[model samples]
Target: MMIHAMSASALSQMDQPAFVAALDGIFEHSPWVAGRAWPQRPFASREALLDSLVDTLRSAPRSDQLALIRAHPELAGKRAMHGALSAASIREQLGAGLLACMPEEFALIRDFNTAYKAKFGFPFVIAMSGLWRGDIIAAMARRLAHEPEVEFAEALAQIARIAALRLAERVAD
Candidate 1:
């Protein structure tokens, strides 16, 4: 029975390294994200799997989304755990090295985080892709102006996008 299952799994994985790699990479970084078994079965098609993963992520509650966001460190700070996130994610979070250049923006991020959390009960969430420090600070200011209900929905949507991109990287083409 074990041999049969193993053989079935091996057959399912044929010519699907990219898909397997994507899922493995995500699980390696965040094993508890969805609380599923490791070495997940190979996806039949990349698009279908990505769609399902996005749906799964979108369905997650706000608390779950916040947990995932909190797993990420501040964009530029000593507390950042470098290897846990994608390089692009790290760069975006750090704000294209602006945090190194401007101390005030760092202060702003700290203040915004406090205010945003006090107002919305969750950390500020952003995709952080292709964003510079000034851009991030600007976004923080703008988002700070949002009502809790608006911000909560936006945060979840952004989280879903981030998860989808991460999952897509793992799926077979």
Candidate 2:
């Protein structure tokens, strides 16, 4: 699982498969975002690469977009409880202190996840890189009140933010 330190210049020159391999995990379980955005390569900067990837997700079909959103696991939910999250998600959630939650905190988050999913038809999503679990819970509660369309857009934006953080970690500035 060694990640070679690939410069932006080096990454820009890669073939589609290579490019996707280097960046596929940045968007949780959605490697197709990078695969589809491969044609927009030769990025002049890391920001450009990020913009291309996010743009690809933004322009995807609704079904594909929903699938991408649904690809994310619930916070402190079954996946976290069972230790089944993807490596990227595990790191993000663990860093957010989700793995350290007390039983009461876990139950509160699980309840929020169930109610939120029931109402919105998707799990709550947020860029958890620097967030505390409490802050995440607060935000989730607030977003539960948003209209579906608004929440959908917000989820995509949060995914983009998560991707941006992941890109910064993996790619050179």
Candidate 3:
């Protein structure tokens, strides 16, 4: 495992591009999150560093926020099946047992993914840690019924959880 053994102070001292690179894969395909939060440096602790990153997400414009949400691949979607997921995403999904789905399980999640994207206009975003395929499918089914606004908020919240997990995995206090 590639663990980033830097403290908050070390990370705060890095240049913007370097900072972004260090945290590149933490926010799905959106390195801009770290790019934007670079100004809020001099973090007091690991928790504060994570807070600044997530705060960037919370305060972003609707379009940018939607872009971040859209940037995440669907759970057990085509990307996972094709072995094309990013390293962080692959690790998380593999831990969730998503990388080895059975044919029937794949078909089931494919249907859920199709319905989810059709309904929400973005892929379903979940922090797949400690979750099972059945749990994911149940979440997809339940989230499919959420109103657009509700589901949108839920997606952002889920993405926040993912970021926290990624940061914890890589960076130390």
Candidate 4:
């Protein structure tokens, strides 16, 4: 697939559907974030567009927020192991070295995935760009202890970090 990069000015000029399509993959499977934030475009900077998108997610109802979080596949879990993740997810995990774990670490991460989901009702979501598998494991261990409300907030923050990274990749300063 070809990645279409354009100036923020050009992106700001797009019609709604085109804008939504352009940013479709930024939030995993939730293009609605862009769609809902569409009217806020002609963004003065990439940061403004990012703020709009993240704000949309932040203001979403509880169920929708949960849906967005749940849309992300577990790290190194079945979907990733089976190669079913989105391109950005693949690169993020592969960059973090989550895809090449030793057997022991892999099993531990799988266990964390199961327990974390059972506890929080959503898969663990982290921005995996500069992290190593060990860092991910430590983060999972640490975040697993958070209360549901706290964890939920943390999840959104992490998603925002991820969106910021992705937006930077697709949009220029």
Candidate 5:
């Protein structure tokens, strides 16, 4: 079903099943985000709604966060076998090809991934939107130097930002 336009009040009046179904449909392309539960009551405004979504994402259990991180494939190599990522994510992965143009950057990403996983037991996480390949590699390299606790917190924060953006788009205007 397509949701062209929906007011907040109209959306709130929907039954539980219908509301979940609508959210599922809108967010199906990004199941990691879809798997999260919505607030019990309607949010008063877009900002309030986004804030809640961000909070949920930030406070998600470590297992959930690790699952989300593992769901993402290495940025510059093969595409993920999973079918649920958004088009934006796919494009970002593809765009990482630019890293290949610079051998040092490519090597840096590889090394950083290794060190990051060794330090934190998970892949490095970053929101690839609005970032170029060089910028991402640079950020990865920098983040590689962070303490495990600091990196974990930073990764969670970036994930929240990404979730907030996705939630904002799915929310009825």
Candidate 6:
């Protein structure tokens, strides 16, 4: 196996603990994701590190994966309303126009969250980095109809996308 090095200057220099600390929130509240990926460092580039992060997650047991998925807060739900989200999540949701939803749009999201969670046993996961609220609403409605297994896979994929975006922003290639 080829072992590569971390490319982000600060990240490249960190010991395992510090490195995990720096990336703790990249995968929502799952710092263990970064902790697991640290053994594979130094990553050759940011993308490689992100791949490792996603790979670590993909290798996890189903229960662990579900836990990671459930760790995310609902978009425009109680967390957003009460400022309980992580700083990164707040910025991401706000940028996606979730925090600016008109009353009707907000209610729609609330309804969707309720229905989606009731179906899948976890929050609907999406990468809202550059998406508008309408896009999110449409996707949520469409995804709600997916089979449980399909939706579970899709949720993991979306989480990877979110983690990739967050990691990219934090680490320069």
As a TM-score, model 1 comes out at 0.66
Each model's C-alpha lDDT? 0.57, 0.90, 0.90, 0.92, 0.60, 0.89
Per-candidate TM vs. native? 0.66, 0.95, 0.96, 0.97, 0.71, 0.93
How much is 127 displaced in model 4, in angstroms? Answer: 0.2
Candidate that scores best on lDDT = 4
| Model 2 agreement with the true structure over 65-144: per-residue lDDT tens digits | 99999999999888888999988888889999999999999989999999999998889999997799999999988999
Higher TM-score: candidate 1 or 6? Answer: 6
Give the number of colliding residue pairs in candidate 3: 0
Shift of residue 136 alpha carbon in model 4, Å: 0.5
Q: In model 4, which regions exceed 4 Å deviation?
A: 1-3
Q: Please provide, for model 6 over 92-156, each residue's C-alpha lDDT reduced to its tens digit, 9 standing for 90 to 100.
A: 89999999999999999999999999999999999997799999999999999999999999999
The TM-score-based order of candidates, best leading, equals 4, 3, 2, 6, 5, 1
| Stretch of 10 with least lDDT, candidate 3 | 1-10
After TM-score superposition, the amount by which residue 115's alpha carbon in candidate 4 deviates from its true location, in angstroms, is 0.7
lDDT of 1 by residue, 49-155 (tens): 54555555556675765666565555554454344555545645555664464667677777877787788776777776566767777887899899877887787
The per-prediction CA RMSD against the true structure, in angstroms, equals: 7.4, 1.7, 1.1, 1.6, 4.2, 4.4
Clashes of each: 4, 0, 0, 0, 0, 5
Candidate 3 positional error at 63, Å: 0.7
Model 1 scores worst on lDDT over the 10 consecutive residues at 1-10
On residues 4-72, what C-alpha lDDT tens digit does candidate 5 reach at each position?
344456556676566555554232233444335454457676566556555565667877766766655
Q: Point out the higher-scoring one by lDDT: 2 or 5.
A: 2
